[model samples]
Every structure is written in structure tokens, then in C-alpha cells.
Target: MTELAVMGPKESEFVDRMGLYYERLGGTRTMGRMYAWLMICDPPHQSLTELAGELGVSKTAISTVARQLESGGMIERVPAPGRQHHYRIVSGGWAQVLQVRLVEVRNLVETLDLGLAVLDDSLPEQRARLEETRDFFAFSNLDGMELLKRWEEHRKNQD
Candidate 1:
């Protein structure tokens, strides 16, 4: 068995909590734990072998989550020496994730509109339900865009 990286009790708890959080969000527990570890790990970047060992999982699992995270803009593969690939949390990755979610919200609203179109006026109650859901998402998307814009401005000023 590969030796695992030593983490204090608090750090271990934090990693587990993050794993649960991501799992609740429809992601794998390992994905969140690995991301949390990378965020607080001393080196701030880790190879697949290192991550697998630290998380007590297989390298293949780490590799799969790494690809998922990279595609989702949550983390990035970094250039490193040797054949082993290293990864780190992308700077502003959370913001990028929110941006992607905003797009998804837009898509949901569009889908709801399609559903509404298929229903007849006689189905008032059903139409009201769809309309309410669609309106909520539409409003959220508008507010989310403004929030992102303000966040960008705040970040710029902080620099």
C-alpha cells in the first residue's frame, strides 16, 4: 500500500466535509476531497499518484476526476517535470463554476419555455407551475450575471 500523506485531524475533517458538500452537489466525494486537499496542501499542486495516495484511492479514479474537474473549469492540469501530470485548483475557479451554472440556468429557462409552449390554455394550473419555475430561474440568471460583474469589478479593484 502507498503511504498516505499525514494530515492533522482538523484537516482530515475539512476534507471529509468538502467531500460531502460536493457529493450533495451531484459530484463524487473524491472530487471534492481532492480539491480541498489541493487547496490546502503545502505544495498547492499534486500529481495523480500523490492525490490517490493522499486520498486513499486509486490513481485511475483520481485521473477520472481530474479530467472531470478540468473540463468543468474547477481545476487545471499544470506543466511539471517528468511523465507525471500535476494539477492545481484554477485561480478563480469558483467564479468560473458559477458562470457555467448561470449558463445552465439559462438553458433551464429555455427548456421551461418549450414545456410551456406545449401546454394548452385550459391547463392553467400546470402552466402556472411551469411559469413560476421558469420565472424564478429567469430572475436568478439576471441577478447572477450582475453578481458576477460586480465580483469581477471587486477583484480588479483589489489588484
Candidate 2:
């Protein structure tokens, strides 16, 4: 296991890439970098101070970003009996991320359904496009749920 602070070129590259990837998905760059660091860091968990030092960010920033990650269900905080608070990636974190995205999909579908109700179905042009979009959203939600269920089975088998 490689300590994030001591990562060589290749591991550092991975952290950088993960940071960019998450940023592209609309997360703050700092939080994305911290999340990448936690995902592959040695010893599994790191205190906020440790993370701040490793990422060269402020402790306040680490605390804020760590709480954001926690709230999003991407990471878990480990409470030590007498030591500082620590953090690690949640098990199947990517799956949890996808599940969170599925909620957004549901929201969009509901909004589209309401729009469809208000639109005149007698006109083929406007209603057709909205109908197509609603269909796509519904399909995506269905497929996403099935994929998660399949992932759960795969994870269970591995365990």
C-alpha cells in the first residue's frame, strides 16, 4: 500500500486524473483531489490534519470538503476512541455515487411527466420530443437500478 504523501509518479498521476475526472462531474477541485487521495491512501484512513498536510490545503478546507463527501455518501468518517477524526472511502463508493445520480434521474423524469401533462398531445412536434425525453429518462432509471442490483450480487459473491 502506498501512502498518498509518498506516492511516486504513477500513483500521483492517478490521483491527479481522478481529481480531474471528479471535477468534470461538477465537484469542487479540492474535494475531488481529497477524495482521490483517500481512495488509494495507505492505512485505509487518514485524519483531517493528515489529509490537509498531504493535500497542502487548510484544515478548515479539509473539514468542509470531508463533510461534503460524507454527506454525499462517497466516504465514511472513522471515529477513533481517543484520536482525531479520520476518513476513508465508503465500500462500493462508486455504486453509491451512481445511486445518488439515479435520484436525479427520477427528479428529471417527474418534471418531464408534469410537462408532458401540460403539453398538447394533439400536436406531434412538441409533445413528441418531450415524450422521447421522458422515455429516455425512464429507461435510464430502470437500467441504473438493475445495474446496481447486479453489482450488489457481484460484491456479495466477492465477499
Candidate 3:
């Protein structure tokens, strides 16, 4: 009969939407669940067993998502010596993570650009919409990169 930190209704909804977003962007549902658990759980760090239990996923899925998050710079694995490894979400300036996702969106825009071109002006309206979307992504990507660079510089100067 113990209570742990849990997401409220709004946060739960947010996590659910984020899970769908990640799934749509080619990540597995388990990966999304892992992220959700990390965001809501107290301490922000968990072991494979804990994550698996919370996410109701197999240990293998937890391991895979942990590796993926680490590689994507969204999380980092902690060394625990003779114990199982633990992971924590990347802290400080969530902006960097946003920038990474924007880059991925920018890549999608490039692919969409190709598809629209192949459509060959047959659907001018659709082409215009796609072009606008592409332009927005390109601009956002550039802005994100610049912001992250400035943040890095500021952090260095603080030292």
C-alpha cells in the first residue's frame, strides 16, 4: 500500500501523445513507454528490471530502448560496478533533444520534397502545402542548431 510519484491526468495524456508520436516516427511502442516511465517516475533513473516492470515489457525490449536512447543522446547509462546498469534522462536544456528531433523532421521534409516533385505539379495545391511544410522544417532546423551552439558557448564561458 505504497504510493509512488505518478503522472497526473494531463501528464498522462501528454505521455500518451508522445508515445504515439514516437511510434509514428519509427520508434517502437516499448521505446515510447520507456520514455514515458522515465519522465514520470521519481528519481528519473531506473534499472532494466524496474523499467521492464513499469513498462510491462520484456527485459530485452528495455535493453534495446536503453541502447537506442543512449545512442540518440536522449539518455545516458550509468556505471554501477558489479550491479546492473542504470539510465537517466539527459538533463539540462531539453532544447538539445528538441533540436535532435527537429533534425529528424527536417530529413523527413527532404524525403517529402522528393515525393512531391515526383508528383510533377499535377496537384499544385498539395505541392504548395508540402513546400510550405518543407520550408518550415528547414528554418526550424537551422534555428535549433544555432540555439544549441549558443547554449554550448554560454556553458563553456560559465566555466
Highest lDDT model number: 1
lDDT per residue as tens, model 3, 82-125:
58878888865266567778879788878978977787778998
Give the candidate number with the greatest TM-score.
1
Candidate 3, TM-score vs. the true structure? Answer: 0.59
Predicted structure 3: lDDT: 0.78
Check candidate 3 and list the clashing pairs: none
**lDDT, candidates in the order shown:** 0.93, 0.87, 0.78
The alpha-carbon lDDT assigned to residue 82 of candidate 1 equals 88
Candidate 2: tens digits of C-alpha lDDT, residues 71-140: 9888999985556899999878789889999999999999999999998868889899999999999999
The collision pairs in model 2 are none
TM-score against truth, every candidate = 0.91, 0.90, 0.59
The candidate with the higher lDDT, 1 or 2, is 1
Alpha-carbon runs more than 4 Å astray in model 1:
1-5
Order of candidate numbers by lDDT, starting with the best: 1, 2, 3
Query: Per-residue lDDT of 74-153 in model 1, one digit per residue for the tens?
Result: 89999988899999998889899999999999999999999999999999999999999999999999999999999999
